[model samples]
Target: MAKVTLPAAADTSAATVKVWDPVVRLFHWTIVTGVVLNLWVFEHGKYAHRLTGYVVVAALATRLVWGIVGTRHARFSDFFPTPRRVITHVYALWRGEDARQLGHSALGALMMLALMAVLTGLGLTGWMMGLDAFWGVKWVEDLHGLLANSVMALAILHVAAAVIESVRHGENLPWAMITGRKRALGAHDADIAD
Candidate 1:
């Protein structure tokens, strides 16, 4: 595995390498599993479907908690894009000059926000659907389907972005997310610098 070494906080002569915390990696894989299982079980197994929905809700809740109290990179503040910065990023992308980031970029952050919104909506609607008054209500059922489809679409875009970034940077971004390691940056990363 490749390791990145930066100037140590205590001593410039020594390099202090930082790595993602375990909670960050756990949340990532758990969400991936939860999303896949939710989709698959919903299609093929009724009981499993509901069970997986609960799992997804749990995972989402965990992610929200981690975002507030976890490591630096895991925090929402670390990756949430500011309006001005997001606009600048979009302009840079149009100019083909966007920088590589250690965490999610502006567009990536937007996608994440969308995905989280959809997931939250789905979870709430699913819960409501379970109530006696709301059970089998056509609008609630349709909203759930709509949110599910949005999640599917966002998943596709997420994968595509990862693939494109990997190809562009000659690094396995998905693997980096899984393993929580990345190669040290170069001068280009310094220049474009997110």
Candidate 2:
């Protein structure tokens, strides 16, 4: 393992660092609730369902804006999953290197971006389904269903990846999102400045 020092709040103690802000956590759980309610709990096209969808759309919009001007780790620039970054992450994993990241890993970042895009698709198609011209349009309805399914699938993968990475890095990642704290940076770990 290579020794590395990160630019962020790197510490040698066994303490946790704040990563996800409250806004980020709220957005995450709000989406989780909205997606669950819209997909499973509420009836399709009902007032509750549509209202939940709109809430989800609002949350997504808020997150998109927050990504531009949020806290250090909340900003997209911290982990945008560029092609080169993803490739390097994958290659390190292939070589059995420690690819643990202080913020989102490259693959995790890709998954987050993908899920957001699919959620946006769902929001757009859902809205179109309510419009005058697109009302009861088969294509819009189909696309909405497809996007919903994509989000569910991606969300499952995201959860599983978080669990696995948490185990690999000796920390509970899902809980970290809730508490907004993660273990301090260590050797062989990549922080935001990495």
Candidate 3:
């Protein structure tokens, strides 16, 4: 894992630091748009729907590569939530600890990975539905529907968690993703080095 650098704690200016790079921001918004379009805007099996799926898959593929070689916070290693970390974070949350992470929180990291996996599964099943070998295959269609529903449910939970964390940590996480920066590390936050 790369070193995670944190800002000085004495700084009370509420400054922001760069975290998500342009590639990461683009990938995030692209997925969000694609999900919203496919879920509520575009009709299923329509040209727009398939095109959006392909676009989202392409973004996912790019993200997979970026996760290995992207900027500090964007790299998966920066916040890959191990089981121990997840448990620690959960315990802290249960105890109402601040536990504000400068980058992705452990639970946030897990949610990200889960969303990606569900999206990949959805894309695969959607692609399969278009193949001749799977024509009239109820299972393929059913699986696709299930994955879509899962994505929606997960998305809702993701937003709710973001809101909860924002309240607890005094930072707008969704805005951070858009702005590609976050409030600098505070004294209470666990310090790290780059």
Candidate 4:
């Protein structure tokens, strides 16, 4: 997770602090790469593509650990959204009035959960295909395809939301994830008072 600090205030200033950590940023991008590789593998039926799935599984495991032991902003607790909050936020979004959050928004949190589920399902199904009993099983193949499609759809939605939020907040959030240094909102470096 990104570090927070309180810098001395400049002349008449107010700012929000940075929130994303390098590991979080890395996990985000690596997942994207893994997803793309999986898609390519599916389309081309390449053995290498199957190998990349293992990489994604590993990355997800790493991310899960980081969520527990990582920086303040990177922890799952920092952005887990409640159902009520998601409903409220969805209503606000429909009405062109949404609340700002330092971390993932309510819907984003749901999407994260969905993505995790789909990925886990895919990994498990793929692993089963390697087992003797499940070898060359049609059902496993079909299930893998279904989960892969779902994951891809969710990923598109995630990117779209990130774009919209970036526009609304005037912050290049995706880029921030890459660099690990978010511009402080004001002269006062502050921690998210979550």
Candidate 5:
């Protein structure tokens, strides 16, 4: 039998590299669907709404565990933003520098963290509302609404940032999240090992 040959990279300007793993991608979309359902489809304080919230909570819990044991880019250690790094990244963007990170950028990582935290808080408050002791409590219900609104605002900002970064770096970031791959690195691109 003839040996199978792999395709040459010379035909393309950049190679394709795996960035997000399947688990990460699944979790990302699952959370998105859950949030959308909770926000627009399901009636608030209903069983379906609460169920979707629980599903989102489960997705978040899995993501937290994955961050501990997942692939390089998926791990928290790889992209957890420090203040200095975030500052530097912001400065680079302000200067119109091409800081093409293979994984989530510093600001992106911070946004991810914030989104997850807000989601967790929403889940908690939602659960509290279900408890008999807290049922019909105005403050608990208000906090839940606040968290829900926060999630929506943060999600909008996240999408806007992704679009801006995609244009700046010449990569389709949202597509990358769906496909689990990104354009390969060029000389000026920042290396993020997976």
Candidate 6:
């Protein structure tokens, strides 16, 4: 059997490090609120739903721009999930090893990308359904519904993963998103200097 070296576990008592920037935090919460409103609070196919969808689209657009030119950890390059990295992360998980990352971990980055893509599609399809040319079009409406469901499914998985990873790594992932900071890296943890 090949030997597998695991990354070191993080020290619980380590100093805190700033990871997420203000823009990243704001974008995350905005999307969460938009999703909640669209899924439950706002009436479907109504003015409020349409308005919330448009706001989500605007937030997604801003996030895309931020991913290109935002702070160190917000830039996509800081945590792009390559195939090899994803596989390595999965393997590490299977082996019960910690791979502490200062920015998004490989699987987290993949989930982030998926959520963003789904949101963009959802927004586009919703807008298309509203257009006069596509008004009352069954396919457009169906696509919109499908995208919405997909986002919900992905969101549930995202939350579960965050909870699992938080327990595994002894860090509050959701709270980190809120406060824009995480426990500082330890000697055994992977160094992700952004």
CA error at residue 157 for candidate 3, angstroms: 0.3
**Preferred candidate (TM-score higher): 1 or 2:** 2
Q: What TM-score, over all chains together, does every model reach?
A: 0.85, 0.89, 0.90, 0.81, 0.90, 0.89
* lDDT of candidate 1 at residue 83, scale 0 to 100: 86
**lDDT pick, better of 1 and 2:** 2
lDDT of each: 0.78, 0.85, 0.86, 0.77, 0.87, 0.88
Worst lDDT window (10 residues) for model 2?
A: 185-194
Model 3 residue 44 CA deviation in Å: 7.0
lDDT score, candidate 3:
0.86
Q: For candidate 4, report its TM-score.
A: 0.81
* Model 3: pairs clashing at backbone N, Cα or C within 3 Å: 3-194, 4-193, 4-194, 5-193, 5-194
Off by over 4 Å in 5: 1-12, 192-194
lDDT of 6 by residue, 84-141 (tens): 8888888887897757888988888999999999999999988888789999999988
On residues 105-189, what C-alpha lDDT tens digit does candidate 3 reach at each position?
7888889999999999999998998899997799999999999999999999999998988887788989998999888776787
Arrange candidates, best lDDT first: 6, 5, 3, 2, 1, 4
**How well is each residue in 71-91 modelled by candidate 4, as lDDT tens digits?**
877888877777677787788
> By how many angstroms RMSD does model 3 differ from the true structure?
8.1
For residues 60-92, what per-residue lDDT tens digits would candidate 1 score against the true structure? 888889889888777888878788768988998
Q: Write the per-residue lDDT of candidate 2 for residues 47-122, one digit (tens) a residue.
A: 8888898898899999999999999888999999888888888888788785566788888889988989999998
What is the Cα-based lDDT of residue 31 in candidate 4?
84
What does the lDDT come to for candidate 6?
0.88
Better of 1 and 4 by TM-score: 1
Off by over 4 Å in 2: 1-13, 192-194
Superposing every Cα of model 6 onto the true structure, what RMSD results?
8.6
